[model samples]
Target: MSIDQHGDHVLQGMSIRKLPKVSLHDHLDGGVRPATIVELADQVGLEVPEDTADDLADWIAERSDSGSLVEYLKTFDLTVGVMQTREGLTRVAREFVEDLAADGVIYGEVRWAPEQHLSGGLSLEEVVEAVQDGIEEGEDAAEQAGHDIRVGQLITAMRHTDRSLEIARLAVEWRERGAVGFDIAGPEDGFLPSRHREAFDYLASEFFPVTVHAGEAAGLDSIRSALLDGRALRLGHGVRIAEDLDVVSRAGDEVLVQFGDLARWVRDREIPLELSPSSNLQTGAISAWGEELADHPFDLLYQLGFSVTVNVDNRTMSRTSLTRELALLAETFEYDLDDLEVFQLNAAAGAFLPVEEREELIELIGEGFER
Candidate 1:
C-alpha cells in the first residue's frame, strides 16, 4: 500500500500505474514538459527563470502550490509563452500524449485555448492542425512502444474575453478533424457560463458537446448557470456543489445528509464532477471541506451516487499524473482496487467520446482491472 517515488502504489498486489485509465479534464497548455519548455523557449529566445528542466519543474510546482489562483496562474505564462509556434505547440501536444500513455491512459481529451497560441502569427486553424499532427504522432509512437492510446481536442476559450463564439466555431469547424468538445477556461468567479450565451446557443444548435469550468472558483449560482444557460454536459472541478448539502449527522461508517434543490438536481441527474485532488487542495477549491486530500468531498459525492471522476487538471503545474492522482486518493481514502476501477469507469462515462467508444473504454477498463 506504499506509493513509490513515481507516485505508483500497489493495491491488491497490483500496480496502479498498470491500470487502464481515462483522462477528461487534462489541459494541454498546463501539461507541457519542463524540458520541452526550456528547449522551445531557447529556440524562441524567451528567457526562462530556471535554466535546467528539473529546476523549471520545481519552480512551477512551487508557484502553483501558493494556494491562490492568481499566483498559481502565473506559472502558465511561462508554459504558454513557449507554446506560440507550430513547432512548440506540436512538440508540447505530442509529449503531453506520450506522458499520458506512459501513465497508462488509454484515452484522453486535451483542452487548450487556440486564441492564446496565435501570438506566433499562426491562424486558428493552423494551431488546431499542429496539435492534431502531434497527437497522431504520439499515438503512433505509443503504439510502437506497445501502448495503445487515443486523444482528442477539447477546444477552449478564455472566459474573460469576447472570443468565445469564435472559439466555438473553430471547435465545430474541426469537429471531424480532431475536436471532440468545447470548454471555457480562465478566471471563474465573476465570469459565468451565461456570459457566453451566444456561443453556448450556437453549440446547442449544432448539437456539439460542451463542458464548463464552473463550481471551482464560484458556487451554486455558477453551477446553476452552467446547466441552465450553457447546457454543460459535465462540470469542471464541480466540487463546490457540496456547499449545497447540509451534513445533518454522521457516525462510524454512516452519515445523514440533507440536499438543497441545486444539489439534488446535480446529484439526481448524475452530472460528472472532475475532481482533481492536488489541484483542488492547492487552489482551495475544497477549503471548506478541509486542507488535505482526506477532506475532499470526492468520497462524499461518490457515496451519494454522484458521477465523481478523478483528474489531473494540470499535470506539470501540480507535478502529478493520472496515476499519481489516483494513488494519492487511494492512500488518503484507503481505497481498494475496486474503488480505483470505479473512478476510471466514471471518467470513461464522462468522456466526450461517442457512446460506442465510451462503452469500449469501459470494457477495456473492466478487462484491465480483472487482469
Candidate 2:
C-alpha cells in the first residue's frame, strides 16, 4: 500500500481516487487553492508572505504543521484576508466544490464563518448568498464535466464571538436554499458550546442539523458540552473521545477495553466521530496516543463499534484531500478495499441529508466500491 506522487493509492487493484466519497468536516476558507490565493491577493493588493503560488503553498503547509491548535488556526487569517470581497467569496466557494468533485467527492458539506468576511462591506446575508451562488455554479460546472456532485453549507459562528444566536438564525433561514447545518468554530479550550446555549436552543427548536467542533482542541469535557448544550448530531474531529477508553489488553486484532460512561453513550448512540488524520496529528488532537498517524485512535474506536468517519478537516492547511487522507490511513493501517468502503459508508450514514438521500448515497458508494 504505497501512495503515489499524486496522493493516490492502488489497493486491491483499484485506484482510490476513482471511488465515490463523502466529505463532512471540510472548511471553506481553509481549502482555498494557493494559486487562487495569490491571484485573489493580487486583485485586492494584499501583501502575501510568499509571491509565487508554490512558495505560498509551502509557507502555509509549514506554518500549519505546527502542533499547537492556535498556531494551526493562524494560517486562516491569510485565507480570510483574501476572502473579504463578494467576488472572492464566490470564487473560493465555487472552486471549493469543483475541487471536491475532482477528488471524487459526490457529497460534501463546506463550513465557513460569514462574519469573518464582512470587512469588504458585505452583510451576513450577502455573503451567504454569494457563497450559495458559487456553490450552484460549481455544481453546474461539475455536472458539465461529467461529475455529479452536491454541496451544502454548514453556516458556522466563531465561538469566541457573541453573535452565535444571529448566526443560528442565518443558518436556518438558508436551510431551504443551500444551508444544511450549523456549527461553532474557533478556539475551543475556553469557549465551550455551553457559552452558546441560546443559539443551540434555537437551532434545536427549529430542528436544524448541528455538528460541533469538539474533542479536537479540547478534551472530553468539551465534547460533553457539545452534546449536552449544543445537541450536536455529529462531532467535528471528535478524536479525543479515545481518552475515555481504558485499554486493558490487546493482542493482534483483538483487544479488551473498559469504556467510560461518555464513551459508552457515544458509541451506543452511533454518533459519528469526524476524525481527520494529518490535521489531528498536526493539532495535537491525538498526541496523548502517540505522535504518528498509526497512533491515532480511529482504528480503536472503529474496532469498538464507534461510527468513525474519515475527514480532511482542512485541505490546503493540511495539504491533503479525502483521497490522500484515505490513502495515508490505508497505508498506515494496512486496510483493504472492504475497509475503505466501510469508511465511505460511515460518512454517507453521517451526512446531514435526508434519509432517502443518505440511502441513495449509500447505494452509490456500494455500487462504486463493488466495481
Candidate 3:
C-alpha cells in the first residue's frame, strides 16, 4: 500500500488518482508548482530560495514541516511574490486547474485572498478576472486532453485585515463569472469570524455561499463564531470541533460520548468539516489529540456522523494532493474503498455549486467509483 512519489496508490484494483473527487478547501496560492514559481519569479525579478524546481519543492516542504504556523506561512510569501501580476495570477490559476484535473478532480474551488494580490497595482476586479480567465483556459485545456474538470474561485479575505467587506463585495461582483463563494483565510485565533460580521451579513443578504477557516488554529468558540457570524456553509479544517465532545466510555466498537451544545448543533446541522490530514499534522492543528496522522480525529468525526470530507489544504506545502490525503487517511484508519467514496460524496455535497451541479458531481463520483 505504499504511495508513489506522485501521491497516488492502488486500492481495490483501482488507482486512487483515477477516482472522481471534489476539492472544496484548496488554496490557490498554496498549491502552485515550484517550477512555475521559479520561472515566474525569474521573469518578475523575485528571489527564490532554491533555483531548481525539485529543490524549491524540498524547501517548501521543510519550511512547512517546521511545526510553526508563522514559519509555514512564510512559504506563501514566496509563492505570492511571484503571483502579483495579472499574467502571474492567470498562469497560476490555469496551472492549478490543470493539476487538479490531472489528479482526477471533477470539481474544485480555489480559494485565495484577492487583497493579497493587489500589491502589484492590480485592482480587485482585475485580479479576479485574471484568475477567472486562467480557470476557463485550464478547463478548456483539460477538456481537450480528455479530462473534464470544473473549478471556481472562492474569493477570500484576510481575517486580520480590514478589507473583508470589500472583498465580499468583489466576490459577489464575480459570482456570475467565476467566483462561487467567499471565505476568510488568514489567522483564525484572535480574528474570529465575528470581526467580519459586516461582510458576512452582506454576503448572506446577497445569498452568496461562505466557508470559514475555523477549528483549525482555534477551537470550538471559533467554530461557533463561524456559524453565528460568518454564516459558514462549510468549515475549513474544522477538526478541533472534536474538542467539544466528551468520551464517556468505550466498549469494543461502541464508544459512549456526550456532545456539547455547539458540537451537537454542528453535527445535527451536518456542517461539512474540510479535514486535511497532512496539513493538520504539519500545522499542528491536531496537536491536542497527538502528533501523528493517526492522532487526527477525522475518523472519530466520520464515525460520529459529521460530514467529514477530506481535502488538501495546501498541496505544495504539505507535499500532498487529494489522492495523497485520501491515501494517508485510508492507511491510517484502515479505510476501504467505500470509505473513500463516502468522503468524495461528502465533498461533492458540500461544494458551493448549485444543487443540480452538485448532483451531477455526485453522479460523476458514483460512476467513477463503479468503474
Candidate 4:
C-alpha cells in the first residue's frame, strides 16, 4: 500500500497505475513538464526561475503550495510564456497527452484557454489547430507504445476576460476536429458565469456542452449561475455545494442531513462534481470545512448520492496524478477498490463524449477493475 515517488501504488495486489481511469478536470497549461518548459523557454529566449528540470519542479511545487489562488496562478506565467508559438503549443499538447497515458488515463479532457496562447500573434484558430496536432501525435505515440489513450480539448475562456463569446465560437468551430467541450476558468470570486451570458446562450443554441468553474473560489450563487446561465453539464471543483447541506444529527454509522433546494436538485440530477482533493486543499477551496483532506466533503457528497468524481486539476502544479489522487482518497477515507472504480465510472459518465463512447469507457473501467 506504499506509494512510490511517481505517486503510484499497489492496492489489493493490483498496480494502481494500471487501472483504467478517466480525467475530466485536467488542465493543459497546468500539466506542463518542467523539462519541457526549460527547453521551450530557451527556444523562446524566455527566462525561467529554475534552470534544471528537477529544480524547476521543486520551484513550481513550492510556489503552488503557497495556498493562495493568485500565487498558484503566477506559476502559469512561465508555462504560458513558452506556449505562445505554434510549435510550443503543439509540443506541450503532445507531451500533455503522453503524460496522461503514462499515468494510465484511458480518456482525458485537456482544458486550456485559447485566448492566452494567442498572445504571440497567432490566431485563435491556429492555436486550436496546433494543440490538435500535438494531441494526435501523442495519441499515435501512445498507440505505438502499446498503450491506448484518447484526449480532447476543453476550450476554455478566462473568466475575468471579455472574449468568451469569441472563444465559444472557436470551440464550436473545432468541435468536429478535436474540441470536445467549453469551459470558463481563471479567477472565480469576482467573476460569475452570468458575466458570459451571451456566450452561454450561443453555446446552448448550438447544443454545445459546457463545464463551469464554480463553487470553488465562490459559493452556491456561482453554482446556480453556472447551471442556470451557463447550462453547465458538470461543475468544476463544485466542492462548495456542501455548504447547502445541514448535518442535523450524527450517529456512529448514520447521519441525518437536510439539503437546500440547489443541493437537492444538483444531487438529484447527478451533476458531476469534479473534486480535486490536493488542489482543493492547496487552493483553499475546502477551507470552510477544514484544512485537511479527510475534512473535505468528498466522502459526504459521495454518501449523499452526489455524482462525485476525483481528478487532478493540475498535475504539475499539484505534483499529482489520477492514481495519486485516488490513492490519497483511499488512505484518507479508508476507501477500497470499489470506491475507486465508482469514481472512475462517474468521470466516464460525465465526460463530454457521446453516450455510446461513455458507455464504452464504463465497460473498460468495469473490465479493468474486474481484472
lDDT by residue (tens digit), candidate 3, 19-122: 99999999999999999999999999999989999999999999899766667888999999988999999999999999999899999999999889988999
Q: Write one digit per residue (lDDT tens) for candidate 4, span 1-371.
A: 45532667778888889999999999999999999999999998999999999999999999998777778888999999999999999999999999999999999999999899878899999999999999999999999999999999999999999999999999999999999999999999989999999999999999999999999989999999999999999999999999999999999969899999999999999999999999999988888998988899999999999999999999889989888988988888988999999999999999999999999999999999999
Q: Stretches of candidate 3 above 4 Å error?
A: 1-5
lDDT of 4 at 255: 88
Stretches > 4 Å off in candidate 4? 1-5
Task: Indicate the TM-score of model 3.
Answer: 0.98
Q: How many backbone clashes does every candidate have?
A: 0, 0, 0, 0
* Colliding residue pairs in candidate 4: none
Quantify all predictions' global Cα lDDT against the true fold: 0.91, 0.94, 0.91, 0.94
* TM-scores for every candidate against the unseen true structure: 0.98, 0.98, 0.98, 0.98
lDDT of 2 at 346: 90
lDDT, model 2: 0.94
Residue pairs with backbone overlap in model 2: none
* lDDT of predicted model 3: 0.91
- Cα lDDT tens digits, model 2, 267-298, are 99999999999999999988898999999998
